[model samples]
Target: MEKIFTLFLFLPIFALAQKESIWDLEELYKTPKYEETDLVNKKGVKSIFYESIDYKGKPTKVYAYYNIPTTERPENGYPAIVLVHGGGGTAFEDWVKIWNKRGYVAISMDLEGHLPSKNHQDRKNFEGSGPSRHGVFHDNNEALQDQWYYQAVAQVILAHSFLRGLPEVDTNNIGITGVSWGGMLTSSIAGIDDRFKFAIPIYGCGFLNGTDGLMGQHFKNGNQAYRDNLLTNFEAEAFLPKATMPILFINGSNDAHFPIPAMMSSAKAPKSKTYLYVEDGLGHGHPPAWDVEESYRFANAIIHNLPLMDIQKTTWDHSKMDFSAVVKGVRPRKVTAYYTFDKGKWQKRRWNSTPGNIKGTKVNAPIPEEATAAYLIIRDVKGMSLTTEVIFDTSDKQTMK
Candidate 1:
């Protein structure tokens, strides 16, 4: 299939006031409900329950596993993160531990309002009690009043506030990251909650309704009123433009839940310093489906205010593409250009990589005649392989979501 690439300037021109506020920050921040839990209180991770407002304006409890760093604390305090799980996932204690090991105070909460199962294998059977089918993608029943996203977004906003209230965390350095559905939620949160210093959404983005075959079909088949409601209330494309914080968009080139066009459309909305990590053969799921090292490297750099390693510029000359990157404080052992020629089916397309020459900070490579999309990958001498999102595609045509 033919790929197309468009360069849109991500300027901070959109104001947050452009979108109507769906949350009452004053009411949500009026009090704290992080009740401590005695379930497996390790040296680093602590389980807790916090009060949140449900759809009916009643008090509801949300369970979460919070992990605080035990390593040498930063002078300002430990940087923190809020971890969000995807559909069918609960508070992942292991996820919290992973961040804690990297010196961050991490909290993983369940959006479905269910506590984590005893083990990973039992998670699939644990039916969440929250509004399972409402207010996420499509909710024709009660609009925003009883939408699950309304409550979930509020809970997430409260999460950031709760983290700021903690004495062990550096409130100004906190960030949020999520997988799958959580990634989409993270996209909304990044735009909704300006308190986050940075956001890394793994295989999730907005513009779902605009997609051809992906998640967009859900909205496409619905009535126009329902489709408009979902887009206005929960789509990331609506919120990302107003987001003031920087974002790192990570996903597989062939991810089914988050297609390239939708991902690109979402990425184009953010006016902040946005980065991309679109890898070949990457798919859905957690951890391995995502790159832990790159994710943490991004978090660490942002928290410590370090320069990001990313492609800075791209120059496409018909059949050849020239690129430049800033890999601060490190040098790459080798640089390569990876591309796929498939017309439309990226999921089954095998990526062919061509070694490129790095002259100073610029990498040059001849574009494959049959290539439709491609990106640059840098394997630093430190044994870390860093990849960029598709910098070039021959077609911008809308396809399956």
Candidate 2:
């Protein structure tokens, strides 16, 4: 074995050696139009001001706001999640009050041409169902490859990572959640990065088809389907399925951009560890659903290591869940879990004391062991409990994974 140091020595940019960042916070943040941007620091929620950062070869600005939590959290690392808005959605993208009030820091950025902050829906009922209906995209293709869109993505991700990097965020439990376009970014990034421990993509996911809204349209420039082949030709499906983190998929039955079958099949998450919502009615809009509320609930469930959430009207009943166990705890480190219901040929789960993963919320392996049966299990892991069982087809249920 040999040790190597001073990486990227052969790279052109590395030769010049000047640190480069992908955020620009000076355009609107420093102006009066953004003057009313609400922010909360030592003070309660106020307005966003301005920030200057280097973006590629030019001076860039980010209109930003800060909202400190109300909880008696320590200053050394409070858990936080990033809130990204959909297309045509800007900074101060409403419903932020809900997050700010819950003792969590929430910041929103404008993802369109760094466009003005007008025409924002905020916390109000959403009327747009897709990007076309969202009413903005004048600079659509202007900032594509590592320019506007990716820059904004990096900025938002950097902002969340910044929170973790801050003296006020818990890096161990940092999470990311977004809606519509935000959801697509969330899924895309969820696959791209390993920093997040939990993720929620509401009205998001399903990029298999090219017509997906938000940023996908930007690449189209009126020729979307062609780019769709470009994407498929490049075979980008390898992205999301590579993610092993616990990701929740919050969606409606009628979402114009995402359909149930496509979303379910396109998602690569293992069944046991995934969260889902398949409700009827309610297309792609945020109202009637407030997706923020879903984000909050899922965030709390994972960040605080609390019980399963109750926000979903649909049923992922425990009767259809099965399990197996692996003994991985190293003696002194241990946990004791009990099953409340049993099903299939196997009435038990792969219950283990493998306390290696943070929160231990990720479960792999199939549920049932053989053909047909029914039972349920209330797994009480260190006082945290959740139920899931199997109703039929128990064959090869335990994967020993």
Compared with the true structure, all predictions reach lDDT values of: 0.71, 0.45
Q: Candidate 2 regions off by >4 Å?
A: 1-56, 74-76, 113-147, 210-238, 269-272, 289-293, 307-401
Model 2 lDDT tens row, 1-401: 22111101110100111132223323212222224433323244444433323344453445445566777885555676777677566555354566667666666554442432455543222111111222322323443322344455555655564455456667787777777767767776665556777877777664433333333344456665534432432112334655667777776534655543234433433222665554434456545446435456667777777666221111112334323232222111222222212221121222222121112433323322222322122233333222222222223222100
RMSD of each: 4.0, 13.4
TM-score of each: 0.87, 0.55
lDDT of 1: 0.71
Using TM-score as the measure, the top candidate is 1
Model 1 lDDT, residue 294, Cα:
75
RMSD score of candidate 1 (Å): 4.0
Report the C-alpha displacement of residue 350, candidate 1, in angstroms.
2.8
* Worst 10 contiguous positions by lDDT, candidate 2: 6-15
For residue 51, give model 2's deviation from the true position in Å.
6.2
Q: How much does candidate 1 score in TM-score?
A: 0.87
